[model samples]
Target: MLEAIRERYIFNKCQVIILDDDGIITLSDDHLFEVPNAQPIENVHPFFETIRHLFDDKNEEHVFHCIHLEIGDVIGNYNVIFNSGNKEQNPFLVLYDFTENCNYIQTIVQRRNESVIALEFEQIQAQRLQAEQVFKNKLIATISHDLRTPLTSIAGFAELLQKQQGTPQGANYVQLISQSATVIKDILDNLLGLAKLEAGVAETQLKKLHLPELTDYLEAIYAPKMQQKGLQFSLKKSAPKNAFIADTTRILQVIINLVDNAVKFTEKGSIQVFLSVLAEAATEPILQITVIDTGIGFPQEATEKIGSFQRFHSTDVEGSGLGLSIVQGVVKHLQGKLDIQSAPDKGTTVWVEIPIQYAAETATAVQTNSDASITLAPLKIIVADDNDVNILLFQQMLAEQENVQVIAVNDGNTVLDELQKQPVDAVFLDVHMDGLDGITTAKLIKSNKLTKHIPLVAFTATNSAEELDMLQKAGMSLTLGKPFTQQQLLQVLQQISATK
Candidate 1:
């Protein structure tokens, strides 16, 4: 019956062996054992020792799980089944191949592990982005606070110098000082503006603008600078004087930045600015402005370096390398395009095209009265700040005005003590103090009805709008950004007095 069963089921490739009680292969269907003749399984493969127990106690039907086997170059998985109907019947061993099933299972396991690793990598990337954003915010705040304080002092002292009747040379020196401070302030503003735009916090204030008036203003501002450098400056306006809807401040800043670059680089040749409408539609019209300068131009290789903190010009030129970057950002924000054309020793021309909408209302010009004088009533005010220079600046700025009693304190606690001694009309509280922060102090003062009526103005070097909003929510009546002009300071006081 065993021989009949082997003949009926086993094929020519089947590895079947009939073993005797001594575990010797009495007969075999194949020579996979690499034996010169039929031999025992123990001498064939290393995995035989692990399955040797099955041959020892084969009293009844015995079956073993799949085992890996490698014979020379051929690899496979096999299940061993032994049949022992009686001692008289030689126990026959049958090895079944399951290599394909094992390979399929291994592939599934490998794919599953890859999926898990991919998920873990995504989580790590998310965490890294969050950390990066937090670091960026902290860096911006620290830089804004540290840099604005000194700039404020320099500008304040320069303004004080202007108020005095000094010699012509001294007046020139004061003008230089003021101009230097303004340049530094512009650089800082550009850096902060880029940060805000990158963080998606910048918002545009759009208004109706007249192109001819804007070009005229630019000519007025840059002509003097060009004359100082012995360069001819001209503004050509080919665009219509139609009113257009745009961000007045941003557009003006972009123009100023472009003109400033042209004036800075040009030595003797003329700098021409041309404004024209490149394309006109009912809703969206394209406006093009060109700033062409004959100066030490850059090579063709440096053309790609025209954007974002890039200095392709000579190192002798003084700039923060942030002008073009800020310009690019503003153009992108306005849905515009920027192009630069230049060559070595030749001139450079920058073209900016922006899409603008037509506004129905006529654009109004901004009016400024340089000769106007401001008068203030006699009132008591408390100033709390940690910086001594800022305190002195406040005193100097208020010295010209009559009967303005200014009491200066160093910390928030001193501010409270001063308030206790006498009720002041307003309190200038620095947001970041050593002992008590301005927000906590304001909260405490507002909680008490006796001191709540007094206006609390936050004096901070931080340019973050979010920080100002937080201070306002904490009961601060108003906020004064650092490096403030004397006019801005007086304007806040005037508003507070008017409210009273």
Candidate 2:
């Protein structure tokens, strides 16, 4: 039984020491000497120092529990109990070492604390980046509007001058003015697009697009220019259907940049655009668009740097190379694929494949028409814009219509007052106006029973996605950007008329 008790005592890692007038009168075992980190009883240095105060008051009994001390050179965690009696009686101390266990627990707590700090830091960084992106998007929108407003007046008057001028020299000057405005607009678009993409805020907004109409629009834009350069341009579609769901703006941007590049490089050869559907079933279809041009082709090395802003044949070509870079970024964001095939002196072919869903209702083919041949029904329109030039441009664009009447206002308050005075067929509003903004005016118009039936159009210079969404929510059914031509305005009028 005694041997069993001794074995259990050592296993429990317990030790006891008795102290008298001479100190260390007796020890239960040699466990303290056996412990590697503990001081020998003969030294009585740290251990005795740790409990000496308890015995100072000899007349009163004292007990110390769970006391930790430096045993030798190593600081260790320990639970110690001490009892002191009168001076003539003995004092006893009990020790239970827990240094290893406490160290392991301390390490775990330190790691957990570090992990919490790291997570908090990451959250803060993410929030900061998100805030910065919002500010950047707003700034881009403002800058675009400010720059494009004057450009719109410049281009609009240039078009008017080109029509009024009879001499070939005067027409040539007007054409240069118009072309310069267009080039400036293109540069602005490329810079804004690149900025958005680099900031990772180039969002995708999906909508049903009529493929045939899109192609027709592109042809109308580039055909005349290509003809002036003595180059052939044609757009073809071999799709099973005419409608697909995608980001309409992004799709237009991609195709426009590709065709523009083709037109810029191709000195004499033809530029052809093809749109086709690639799929095994109608439920999940992939739209493939290919742009082939017999242009001054680039080297194979240039093909490898599609997403980068690396200019090709820079010695002869005049471009920042941001066009193709914007195209690549938009394609990637849409989870599509882009391929370029080219060789020196050989024409280049660029193709993009995007997964899409066919619209629920397929649209019929749109018959293309010249702007001069189109006309609108007799209608009274209210136009609101802060800029007098924009208002004047609108009046001139509508002057050709036989019975169309345009009532112009410089602010949204006047627009509202006009609506209150008379019934109009449509309301055209610039998004930013003095006194009352266009968005609030739109909401008021939409909410009122008297004016809610009229078609609302946002003809503004700001075209940011966030602002567009705001305009839509405020009940604008259609949005046309500034620097628009007579044809575009007529198209918007027709659509509004048709909807009504």
Clash pairs detected, candidate 2: none
Give the runs in model 1 whose Cα sits over 4 Å from its true position. 1-165, 277-281, 305-320, 360-372
Least accurate stretch of 10 residues (summed lDDT) in model 2? 311-320
lDDT of 1 at 35: 30
For candidate 1, lDDT tens digit of each residue in 398-458?
A: 8887768999999988888888899898889899888998889898888888999889999
Measured on C-alpha atoms, candidate 1 has an lDDT of 0.74
In model 2, the number of clashes is 0
For model 2, residues 335-420, the per-residue Cα lDDT tens digits are: 78888898767889998987776665543233456646665677889999999999999999988886679999999999999998
Q: Please, what is the whole-model Cα lDDT of each candidate in the order they appear?
A: 0.74, 0.75
